[model samples]
Target: AQSVSQHNHHVILSEAASLELGCNYSYGGTVNLFWYVQYPGQHLQLLLKYFSGDPLVKGIKGFEAEFIKSKFSFNLRKPSVQWSDTAEYFCAVMPGYSSASKIIFGSGTRLSIRP
Candidate 1:
């Protein structure tokens, strides 16, 4: 079975501050990685993803992630964060190429941005 781990449970930052959230998986074979963000009361939205091709993938809202195969990591990053970016970020993984595969999610990282 595959699992995702998010090291940071909560993160607080002021506007314009840089942000990075750690995410790791337990799978050793081909897998899919994704970052999803959920706002205060909104539905979960896809931030970024890495299936194949480039290891470095860019996402919406100035977000990006690097798929480090050797480290089994897909860390999310943003050069500068905004107050609107405040949300609960989740790291998810699905083993194999099947979109119907069960997607395992991390515990989630809550991000709070100061005005």
Candidate 2:
């Protein structure tokens, strides 16, 4: 079955730590990949996305993700993570470009940062 996978269930780090979160999908056709972050008491926000152009895309707050078509993966990365980066990250995939198409979200990865 087509699905998005996030292998990491939880991650712990201190301030100024680097982060890499893995995301992979099972769909065989073209797909739009996204990473959404939700702070402890805030709504989800779009961290980054990949559709048709260059596979590497940068998002807000120094966050970025690289889409690898061959591996069916779009992994999120941050050079240095701060306490503010602690949040629940979700990897989502849309099988097609249609706005009506439902986006499948991977099981979230919870990140905790020590002060």
- The candidate maximizing TM-score is 1
Error of 2 at 90 (Å): 0.2
Off by over 4 Å in 2: 97-99
How do the residues 1-92 of candidate 1 rate in per-residue lDDT, one tens digit apiece? 67899999999999999999999999888998999999999999999889899999999989999999999999999999999999999999
For model 2, where is the 10-residue window of minimal lDDT?
Answer: 94-103
Q: Global lDDT of each model?
A: 0.94, 0.92
Native-referenced Cα lDDT, model 2: 0.92
Q: Estimate each model's TM-score.
A: 0.95, 0.95
Q: List the RMSD of every prediction in angstroms.
A: 1.1, 1.2
Q: What TM-score does model 2 achieve against the real structure?
A: 0.95
Best model per lDDT: 1
lDDT of 1 at 4: 92
Question: In model 1, what are the clashing residue pairs, if there are any?
Answer: none
Instruction: Look at candidate 1 and tell me the lDDT of residue 69.
Output: 95
| Number of clashing pairs per prediction, in order | 0, 0
